[model samples]
Target chain A: MFRHIVLLAWVAEATEEQKAAVEAGLKELPGVIPELLRYEIGPDAGVSPGNFDFAVVADFASVEDYMVYRDHPTHLGVIADVIRPILANRVAAQYSF
Target chain B: MFRHIVLLAWVAEATEEQKAAVEAGLKELPGVIPELLRYEIGPDAGVSPGNFDFAVVADFASVEDYMVYRDHPTHLGVIADVIRPILANRVAAQYSF
Candidate 1:
């Protein structure tokens, strides 16, 4: 199995209302992307010492499957219309097991 | 190799000043924790639709190493002192290859 994990940080100054709106937009993505085998998103717990604000974890059968999800048009639309506006920075890592 | 990935989301209402302070506390962890083989933390890009704010990716020789890092005292101090206060929610995943 291959996992594509993304860590995202948002502009900490965003209001609660803005956060909720952005979260709602994000919640709409899983159904639109067929390649996603398992997808999850949520806020950080008090576990690590970092400025990160949110995270996305998705599982794919392989790297190629992950790439398809990464490049999907609907996925791109979400990035442009919703994610980009509120985010301050982001990072990703892919691993296989 | 085993990978420990953590997805963190912070309270959206945090200020820029608060974000910086939290980040500084996080940046101090690597040196204190010896088991972390490859640790990378960053904000999310506008790639995926999600309200998440931060991400952490760490590689270990094995799952045991990851557990050690997870339960370490210095690590917990950072969590309690810096991470818990700012975060809203969190998730984690472990994989091997």
Candidate 2:
């Protein structure tokens, strides 16, 4: 099994409208792919002292399954229309067990 | 080896003062414990379209090592003075291979 964590940071002054649009875009992802075993996203709370804006956690059966999700049209569309516009930086890490 | 991911979300409107204080607390963590193999903290970008604010990724040689970090006095002090007051939500997951 493979576990992937994708970390995202947005501009500090991002507007409410932009944050809403971003959340809407994310909600549309699960329906676009079957490879996601577990997917979750939420805002960072007081757990760590950092500047990150958001996070997504996903689990796939294998790297191949993850690849399918990565290439899906809906995923790409979000990147183009939603994610890239507001994001300042991103980090991703994948591991297998 | 064990990989642990801690997901944190803060109030979107967290003040600059709060953010700075939190970051200071996190910066002081590594010196208090030697078991942390790899510790990285950052904000989430626009990768997955979720609301998480920040994330910390750490690797430990064993679960016991993680426990040491968890129980360290300095770590606990930070949680009380820096983390608990400013954080709204937090999530953590652990896996071994």
Candidate 3:
């Protein structure tokens, strides 16, 4: 399996509405993009102090499938409209098991 | 269930020997630290153009269980002796299922 993990930290000024919008936007991607074999995302539970605000773990069958999801128009739209504006920092990793 | 996700980037100057040691050290943590109910770690597969070098996703029954794993001496030792030295950047998030 190919796994794509993304950790997002929201800007300090990001409002709850904006945060929720981003969360909902990401959670819906799997349904909109057929290449996403599986998707899991949510806000941080605060167990770890000073951690990022959100986490995403998505899976695909191969690197090409992952790239298709990555560059898909709807995914790009989410990044541009919802994610980038309120972002503090982002870190990502792609790995295989 | 509670999940702990960590993304790590090795310093550009870090040697392969050092990176290998860190990977091996982390792979051994779940066996040594009984609090970890599940563990997964691996180097990036390079599908992403720019990304962290390694990823870790570990699971615990609860936040308290996660803390036990976090503060366990074996974990602390690996972080201090292996991870911290080569870490270029780290981003983490904790969340519930």
Candidate 4:
């Protein structure tokens, strides 16, 4: 499977309401994007202190499917609208295993 | 399941040899540590530009098992001896999904 993982930190002023919106926005992606074979996203569980604010894991059958998902309009819209406004720092990695 | 995802960027000075060491070091964990129900680690596939250099995704049966893995001496040694020296930036998220 090809996987994409993202670890992101939130801006200091980001509110609980904004976090909820982020969650709601992310929940919409999988159903709308057919290439996403598996999708899981969540705020940090706080088991380890100083971890990133949130994480996203998505899987695809191949890198081509992942590439399509990367530029899909729906995914970009959520990122530009909901995620970017509150994002402090973010990093993503894609790999096959 | 409980999950941990780490996205890391290597220092500019980090060599290919250092990266190979990191990969070799990570491969040892699954056999010795046993709490990891699943573990996948790799340099980025580069399907997108400007992503983190490496990623690690690990899953456990529960958060408690995750905690054990988190503090395992062998794990800590690898982080300190192998990873920390070459790490430029890193963000990790622990979550349940």
User: What lDDT tens digits, residue by residue, belong to model 4 across residues B2-89?
Assistant: 9988888999999999988998998899999899999999989877888999989999999999989889999999999999999999
Judged by whole-model lDDT over C-alpha atoms, candidate 2 comes out at 0.71
Residue B13, candidate 4: Cα error in Å is: 1.9
* Tens-digit per-residue lDDT, A42-66, candidate 3: 8999866789999998889998989
lDDT of 2 by residue, A2-97 (tens): 656866778877787886787688777887787888776655433445635666667789878888888888888888898888888776656554
Q: Which parts of model 1 are misplaced by more than 4 Å?
A: A1-69, A72-97
Lowest-scoring 10 consecutive residues by lDDT in candidate 2 chain B?
B42-51
- The lDDT leader among the candidates is 4
What lDDT does each candidate get?
0.70, 0.71, 0.90, 0.91
lDDT of 4 by residue, A1-97 (tens): 9999988899999999988888898899898989999999999998778898999999999998988888999889989988999999888899988
For candidate 3, give the lDDT of residue B71. 89
The true-versus-predicted C-alpha distance at residue B29 of model 1, in Å, is: 1.8
Model 3 stretches with alpha carbons more than 4 Å out:
none
User: Could you tell me every candidate's TM-score relative to the true structure?
Assistant: 0.52, 0.53, 0.93, 0.94
Candidate 1 interface CA RMSD, Å: 8.7
Using DockQ as the measure, the top candidate is 3
lDDT of 1 by residue, B1-91 (tens): 6666766677978766766666676667788877888776655543446535666777789767888988988788878977788889775
- Candidate that would win on TM-score: 4
What is the C-alpha local distance difference test score of candidate 1?
0.70
Candidate 3 chain A has its poorest 10 consecutive residues by lDDT at A23-32
Q: Which candidate, 2 or 3, would have the higher DockQ against the true structure?
A: 3
Better of 2 and 4 by DockQ: 4
